[model samples]
Target: MNVLKPLSGSTLALLACMAAGALCGLVAEPAGALAYLFGQLYLAVVNMAAMPLLVVATFFGLRQVCELPRPAWRVGTIGALALGLMVLCGVAGTLAGALAMPGAHLPEHAYATFGERLLQSAGDAQEVGVTLFDGADAAVSQTSAYGWREAVPDNFYRVLAQGHPLGILAGTLLFGLAFAALSREQTSMLGNVFEGVYRTLEIIIERANLLIPVLAFGTAAWVSAHTPPAMLAAMGSFLVCFLACAAVLGGAATALTARRAGLPLVQIVASLKAPLLVGLTSGSATASIPHTIEAMSARLGFSRGIVELIVPFGAVFVRAGSALYFSLATVFVANLYDRPLGAGDFAVIAFASVGAAFLSSGKSGVATVGYMGVVLSLLQLPAEAASVLFVTIDLICEGPRNVVSLLAVCAVIALVSAGLPSERVMPEPLRAQPQVRAPLRFALSRGQLALVAGCAMTVASLIVLMGIGVGAK
Candidate 1:
């Protein structure tokens, strides 16, 4: 049995902010520019925290794994489970698109609307002396540049510096394994350093979370104001179809977890609400890491070590959410282009989708959508117009995607982590507990100062970029 509480205050506030922002944006679109600045600043901070969190978390998870009995088997089992589920998710999404036929039977009004949108886009492109498909052409031509080397890079430092997720994941995984394999005498100082960094970063994120509601409001306003309402209406079927698949995938995962954990569904929801809300609002699992770990371990009665291992690792490499997105988007594009989809086409789409989903990690917005073009090119579909509509109204789409991804984490843990939580440690909630005494503090370590500097520089640069955009207007 689990002891998860009801939805936390922050979760409710985030939802309210998003709703308010949507309504406000629909009514007062003029504030969008201001909102964009706030939204970017918030995301930039999250981005700043992400890489360091990844390294520290990888250390924690891998060290825990190595301590567990039969560590190699546990790692292999988790990998196989994640990979298989992601593949099935891709196939399921493609099947939903095929059955729904969202893009095939567009209303007459939608046809006119889509035609005008394309013409306007083409006009804009022509004014700049480039075709609408030029980007896709250049993109397809560069496909050869990505390969196994990029996935498991030899130049770890270069890729780490560039903030590539796959490279970071590979490098940190190997580093953590080596660290865990070393004698405690040899690794104690570095282990303590990693633990301190993780704790410090957690505190930093907790403090920064005060801006989440404002970020939600700004992000909602920014999306609503920029995207045409009519465009959303015109493609409502695709949105609905995507949402339906997400519901199926998410519901199944939740139900399975509840059944296996012997916990009631309401209790499961109570435990997960915070992380799920954060995921939906921020669309960054890294931002939800602390909430996710506590909820799964302390509230939902799973192993903290296992929860930590899966959340970050699964967020980076598993990518069931991206698999679903790629599969459905590919099928929708095929239908939109009037390309015939054969049995073989579905097979190709499924496999390509899984691969593309893995490759699209660490990317967001337009960069994430660009992977859809790779699948489209393989099937000879017109990729240009297909993505334009999706991009225009992606904010709504991303919430479901992020939520599904988070649920996938829980689902894996529930299925694979079957033991009871006998060794769980319950601490007072961070807000409820007050510090007994202030510790004697010295000046910041050089490493800590460097981290603070990096975060400050990242946020400042993004704000400056936002200002440049505002000035151009």
Candidate 2:
């Protein structure tokens, strides 16, 4: 009877799917798997739509800001430091968690019935030094659970969920940038077409998001219904590691931003209160943009121009929170499945986290899975399983991720401010003018396309090499 049928139908279907999965949990282990698979498909559909939406919004925003003259050396230096901080925090936290592996074990079975499932899962063998699971203290030896492979359909779902197809996110980003370029300068006919595409994407993204409550409720209900407390306990150490890494990343960015801003750390923390509140409430950075920029400009004395330009850009590139989340999430999944992380895997994770951050537009919801999907695909992880955790646990840690991202933006603005001599600081009003121009002609020229194509091909070759390595395992 609901008048809005598509919306109502999608919601009902998602809920029913989740309910069925949860009910299955009571039946048997296969039920749990079935429930998990259902959750995975729901997540996959949500995530597949996410990458293009986020990539387009982000690249378009970046292209719009790309023309602003900056002391690139200064901004780059700070940006690099911020990036390094994320990578370092990730590595260090992972190392600490790894070292702690010897003592980790699942909570007692009484806590949740899933402990048996968790333990059965832990039977798979891993390398000598690697700690296979976060909670388990026992080192996995070469045992019966060898040469394990995921169920096929689920495996494919994960591949796409991991989103690492060579140019998938990148291509979308390029298209977004191209779309934005053409949008501003083109005549009505071509412009109208591009606008239509953008509008269509916008509508689709909006509709997809309407399913969040359904997804969230179903995911939560299903988790509560199906997964025993022990499964939750089994996941404790992994969650702890992730939160710890996110904290380090967020904490470090906050400290750095406060220090670099030439203000008290408390003031820096206070400065973020507005944006943090917005980010937490809305769960989207793009939505929080006006508040974040307003707060920065009014309270923090950041010029509106810099705040607007830098914050938006920071949402994409300076995502310390999301970067750390993405990296740690991958590690957690690998750990969950008893997959070993090699040096090459580590490098891929680090670079990919940065790239994913760059590609993500600050729409605060679960679109992160899209980028995560891309990474999982590239790294060849079981992304479907990863998406299961993200949907269920988004509220658990998104706060820290958003805070870290905000701090990173503040830091960039601060760093930019520091490098500008007083004279070069444009008046606040002038800063908002059309300071950057889109070189549409040049951007669409044959040369740029060829260059991008070449880079794409090179990256593809490297990915193939990486795939071969993954295959060997």
Candidate 3:
């Protein structure tokens, strides 16, 4: 049985639910509305979990990286490259979308119709403006927004409008420091309690993860119900473009990396395709680890020892996709707020994206710790904006991210294992070797969950409040 079978099952169910919601809308109206609300709420919860998870995971993951030798350069180089690519993609993609926009006069209509929705989805508003269009068929009047927010929800608006989750995220940082401070060698009980808190958070995140699919289904169904055929059609093109961009970036990186490693890029990509697909569709790299490992070793000829060490290690530090997304997202959010980032801000963003990627892990739970904290503290960004901007589109980003990660890890494994005795080393004896498992695993597993959960919960709560609205109606 596939270790990620559970993840696959959930994803399938989500697809089914979306299909059902779409068709049900054609069959009737009211049922579609109900489906829409429930589906949306399901997504809401998932989104709820994402930010805090990112925050906590980031903190612990970074701390873990800090404990390693010579990781700064390895993690930093890949991260910087990933960040640069993402920023380029974001700017280029937005410009391309604007230049090639189908309807010249459609901007106002889009904004009037999708402004609230886009805000909810992307956490900011589009700078819609009038433009003249001279097409082959006819001259047309048009309005256009620069990015993907035109299709999302209202929660995004709330996030931008109010600086949220930042407060809660701030609180979590204080708590983490406090926990460490209170847990000096003398305070055994405090230390034990902190340890238990971390463990419990991991357990809860792991178990609660099972609910993601059910929620995903409901959300898809809801999206199908409310969105018109035309909107869905437009979204289809966007998804295609997004996937294409992700593939090109991933493919290029794999080829270049493989060339450097003297491995077959095709073999490496083919080995990772299913896992990459699963990861993209599910938007969870953590869930894709088992399959990634299997593909690396069984199909790609990596030793078990190498696969285990590099894959997991890569998951925490080499979040190529997340790094890309964060870079794009930071800029996109800034644009929405009408606070275009300057060189200094961009520099800070570059560093933060690298840090966030280092802090990110392949585990699904509580991985956002350092990430959430860093963004909120370093940037003048609204925390609620972060919560809304990427939640629904995570899978859209994860696909390429995982592929990049797969390639990066493959390179590392190839380099490391080429020097070793076995190209197919057993896991047991490999773990016994100091060169393979212990230090790596120890780095990944240390206090990762507690930080992830605490930060994620805090972010989620803020997002929920933004969507549901706080105080009065």
Candidate 4:
């Protein structure tokens, strides 16, 4: 067997391809068109896998969560904390983006460029709204990001093929829950098959990233050959907001860990230093897991089993980093298209972001950014066109994203291991919802848990539909 397993990524190959791409863009303008085609080929291949992976990953990941050997109360605590933390992170991002207006107030040229791309995503209507400022036609196209037809799938395969991220996400959630409900004995064989499939997709995508040079070159040449320079600044502004949000979350996580562990803030920071660095450099939470476990259990003195359980769970299931990124990024797109956001819009941004982050698990780099399609679709934003610019800056953003992921796990472990009791938070017959203040409280039964979950999901779905309906108008 081959030793070392090829280092598990194509980082060097990516660099080489990028060099070749840059060279082509600079020295061979005539051949630039050919390079662009190859890049398009790469994008198409990735998109083909992106949607399928969204489904398979969701199904498989949820099954694994369900299969945890822990008791029902433990599982419910994890679920509640993860969901609450993720929503908290997303809402924070939405606030930051709303106040900062990263995609708003762009310079004249950059504004027009994004506006055109927004209009372009409306395909058939693009002809009428050649410019974003084309009066009523442009106004109509901008508000058309959501509809009844798009939210509900008639045929799942067709919807997946059409690049409908929200539709795929909705379908996958229902399917994943049903699959997760099957006993391990019943799903043993199929589980192995999907596990293999998910791993294979990861490998394929990693290898495909090696050809990112092609995509990079094409994107760079296309931008340089056509657009003005101000677009770069627009992207930078968004990144600044993204990093700001990550920073805010990261600092809060550090504080929470210090308080929960009853350790000094300096000590907590020092203990977390290694994993934070790994996350910052690799931009992969999996890469940082070893360091995170060591920091939490070995250095910080949390229970080893709990540390192990919560770290990986936080890395994959929590996904607050992606949640934060999505909230800001989605709102950024809305502002780019000059779509106004009301209170309902912010609610949609926060809710859609958490859902999108769940599907975004196990993806990195281009694939991670590409999966923004889900949230964008929910908001009826132009995922296809907006992703073009977003992907160009995605690499620069990953470091902060990963760093936040590590910090989030630290905070989660602190909360789960010491901050709260390991009891279920079932729906009570109380007048007001007591679960809000102390989520995942002690002493709930299985039947009550199910009833509470059903009620929560029902209320959430109604809110989403209403928010979507309001935004689309």
Candidate 5:
């Protein structure tokens, strides 16, 4: 029982998926393709929930930030620091990619195959071209003409239904602020309702995450089976560069966290093992929040005031890992196409990567790809092929990406807690919750079963239609 207790469901799932994916990659061609399809289908389903999850989560998170103790500057300071770290990581990754030159000198046949797959997956080259460049002038002109007209939504429902995530985020923030302005009784009532919704969404998101291992397996098998051996070597170089950058940043974050928390680096790392393992296996810092808060408040003895405020805010806003990947990926794709990146191009990558990190964090299934597309377009590089290829190996990078983000959160918590007055710290009795051991069950609820069925049917229909479309072609 003790041995079994140590292995979490996500850890077991990760190992199982790795083994299955490697076996399929080596000996199962048709199965690999099918697995890839399932992976995409799973991503699509998960993505359907990402916007709502982020919207409600951010809404409540902002409330916490707004209600922070009198020195509002503390929250702002932590936020600024987190943002700086994110951008710094991005710059580092870009520099590393520039030096490493991953994916450079790819074999012609491998490049051609990737290009063909990209074109097929993306479809409508004309549309891609227009979206890539044509909107820039209009966007710039609109920005120049900014007024109430630009800020006000003509149709709020349309903005949400059409999946304008930034618009939704803006709306949620505005609503959160308005709620904060309400009378105490009214605010509490509404806040409770919103919190309930947020908790429910969190549960759904957690359940959806159980599919991650299957998604990882399918993606790994497909990439291994389809990609050329030389291309794989190039990808290996990119992975090394990315991992190296993340490790350096992560190590620095650990040192800072330990220093700020007044604990040894080893102690801090040891204390974070549960959250770190969960973050790595789940590939989500957001999903690891409960454990992170528990670790910080209970094990590490941080005050609730600091723990409750910074951790959630950091989870949604601080995205060092995503920023790093975006910068590294942009450089890698540029190299694959033999596109030369000057200083100006690197600057654009850095800025765009940071901007995209904020815009796409808390979303699902390689949100970085969309942001990378924007970066590619800005650099006048062909984006679709690169975007597709990036998605292929996104799962492989997710674990490290999440770990970096978690470490950033911990670092911010430590920094914020250290700066607060000693009196602001919670008393020991309030700081620790009694440990409760309960039987662990691994069964799905009825609602989860229904959701699975619905997703399966939707995915099947989409796959069938896709097959028919291919046959027609």
Candidate 6:
């Protein structure tokens, strides 16, 4: 009965739908289109609840943070670590892209065709120009200087309506602070109300999450039926490199966190399976919040207060996966155009990519594409074609990206828990009966499992590259 949980059902459904969608896409275009529409509808349903959930959860989370001992230092330490990890992701992605050289062998005609299509789509008459080793002069001149004005919303309602998450986050934090400053009686009443709201939204999101398999089916069908083989082939190098990086980084992060927490790697992985699978298949880390909180507190024995405080905040702000993809995609586009990059250009890319990653939305690929434009524009690069190209394969890449993001959050949870006193951490509940550990012929722990999986993926990627010949047209 325990094995028959919602997460297991969802995972099985997702895998089945993906396979069915792929088959339908290959065999019948109309059927695939229908499935794709269903997926879009599911995405819309879940997205409807996403922002509200974030608002309520974050409000309560920040309120709790304010109650922590030395709250300022705790917040600062977590923020710094999150930001540092994002920067590392960006740097790693850039290095991988450079080594893979995704578009180095792109056919001239194909490049011209893509560029022409992009220009046509944008209705732009400007001649496409190419230059080598251009410094940050163009980027500096073209980029909008960041200021407090951009961070602060002009109208709270407009920001919320427009789904500007960062603005909402800012507004919520301020509101939480004000609530905290109230008299104890007033604060208690408001806290109860906020908790009620958070729980209600959490319930709504959980129900909405049951629709993920339908979403996966449609996305897989649409992507398979509509994306041309040539475009997919063109994206092969980038995809391989991106997935490889994700696997390695995610695995390493998970292992380190597990070891630091003094938990059996297998137990941690087992507990996290549901949220991880949901995140990967749904391509939305926010959708997995309920499961993440459960895994952290109920399963891994983290303090509920800390888990609640960190996960919501991390879901919105700590997007290591998005940062990685942005850096990699920028490099891919540069390679496609034979653009020579310098140390300064990479620095700008790192800065822009990390900045944009913080602003990534958890709903769908559309917001991601829009954000990529800002990053490209900051580098004074033409974004029209690159945006279209990336969006074409965004569905395929999104799952792994979400997985990486979730893993980062888990790592943060472990680190934060480690710093807390033992009394702050919760003890595991007593089971109805003593659970037996089954001995295996080859006993590989969860951390070792992660390492093995990562190494396997790396080897597979290399073999595929060699077999296909990276220069293949």
What is the lDDT of every predicted structure here? 0.77, 0.53, 0.48, 0.67, 0.70, 0.74
Question: What digit string (tens of lDDT, one per residue) describes model 3 on residues 89-157?
Answer: 444444433333322333344334334554445443455322212231121011011011222223543
Off by over 4 Å in 5: 1-6, 9-13, 24-71, 105-165, 181-230, 283-285, 303-312, 422-473
Give the count of colliding residue pairs in each prediction.
Answer: 0, 17, 43, 1, 0, 0
Error in Å for residue 154 of model 6 = 3.5
lDDT of 6 by residue, 108-204 (tens): 6666656655665455546644332354345433333422333477778877877766677778778866765666686787678877887887777
**lDDT tens digits, residues 1-473, model 2?**
23323433343544454465455555554545543455445445544554444444444344444444553454466557557655664455445445444113444452244334434344532322222233221111111011112111224445345554323434444554455455455635654564466456555544544443344334444455554565455566656777666666667667776665556778767656645644542245443454566566666565454465455455545667777677777666666556677878777776666656545543345666656654565666655445655654565566567776776677666666544444134433445677688676534678888999999999999999999999999
| RMSD list, candidates in order | 21.9, 24.6, 24.5, 23.2, 23.5, 20.9
- What is the alpha-carbon lDDT for the whole of candidate 6? 0.74
Residue 286, model 6: lDDT of 76
For candidate 1, write residues 1-473 as lDDT tens digits: 01112222367666777777877788887675576577677677877886688778888888877887778987888888888888989999989988988788777888787877877877877752323344654665575357455668989989988888878888888888898888889988998998899888877766555566666787788777777777888888888889989999998889988997777898888788777877787757577777788788777767777777888887777778888988898887777767889899999899888878777776765677777777777777666666666777677777787788778878888776755444234423433567699689779999999999999999999999999999999
Off by over 4 Å in 3: 1-106, 109-115, 118-245, 256-264, 359-379, 392-407, 418-473
The model with the greatest lDDT is 1
Alpha-carbon lDDT of model 5: 0.70
Q: Native-vs-model 3 lDDT? A: 0.48
Candidate 5 lDDT over residue span 432-464, tens digit each = 667679988889999999999999999999999
TM-score of decoy 6: 0.80
Q: How close is candidate 3 to the true structure, as a TM-score?
A: 0.46
Q: Distance (Å) between predicted and true CA of 362, model 4?
A: 1.0
Badly placed stretches (over 4 Å) of model 4 are 1-71, 112-230, 419-473
Q: Which stretches of candidate 1 lie over 4 Å from their true place?
A: 1-12, 125-141, 144-147, 420-473
- TM-score-based ranking, best first? 1, 6, 5, 4, 2, 3
